[model samples]
Target: MKSPKQQSGDAAERRAETLLTGRGLTTVDRNYRCKGGEIDLIMRDGDSLVFVEVRLRRHKDFGGSLSSIDQRKQRRLIIAAQHYLQRQRWQGPCRFDVVGFDGSHEANWIKDAFSA
Candidate 1:
């Protein structure tokens, strides 16, 4: 059986995916991973590729989910993204996005949340 924490994270990722697809984005991939890092979700937003990080924080003791993504994490995401793009031979446009959860039904989406 999945642990409560794992289940919560899965549910949160699903919520983020639903919110995005409802807004006209098409899901390209989920849980894209490389040796460098992991991308929670990857979606097509118009002509661009959006690499997403889904962060769910049920408590506030360590601050919010948004603040959890620091420089090191950003670099890993970037490296994974680069690997994905290269393997797919994609040369259009790409951006980083963040889906933050605070024990809520709705997630907060930040488009172009970070740069590589």
Candidate 2:
């Protein structure tokens, strides 16, 4: 059985996926993992490949959901994205995006959140 936290995270990722798809992005992959890192979602926006990170924070005590993606996390995402690109032989344009849910509010989608 999945833990409550894992279930909640899954729900968050699903919500993010739905929102992205509604906005015209097609899902390429989800929860893609490599040796040292994982990507929450891989999507295609027009001719560009998009790597997405989904974050959910029920409480806003310390920081917002988007703020949780710190430097270390960014590094991991970048490394994982690089691995994915090499494996898929993707030489086209790619970008990083972030989908964050803070509390019970609407989703926040930030395009080109960072670079690889």
Over the stretch 1-116, how does candidate 2's per-residue lDDT look in tens digits? 99998998999999999999999999999999998699999999999999999999998768889989999999999899989998999989999999999888999999999886
What local lDDT does model 1 show for residue 34? 91
Please provide, for model 1 over 12-88, each residue's C-alpha lDDT reduced to its tens digit, 9 standing for 90 to 100: 98999999999999999999999999999999999999999999998655878888999999999999999999999
Q: What C-alpha lDDT does candidate 2 achieve relative to the native structure?
A: 0.94
lDDT for 52 in candidate 1 is 90
What are the C-alpha RMSDs, in order, of all predicted structures? 1.1, 0.7
- List TM-score per model, in order: 0.94, 0.97
The deviation in Å at residue 15 for candidate 2 is: 0.5
Clashing pairs in 1: none
At residue 49, candidate 2 shows an lDDT of 96
Against the true structure, whose TM-score is highest?
2
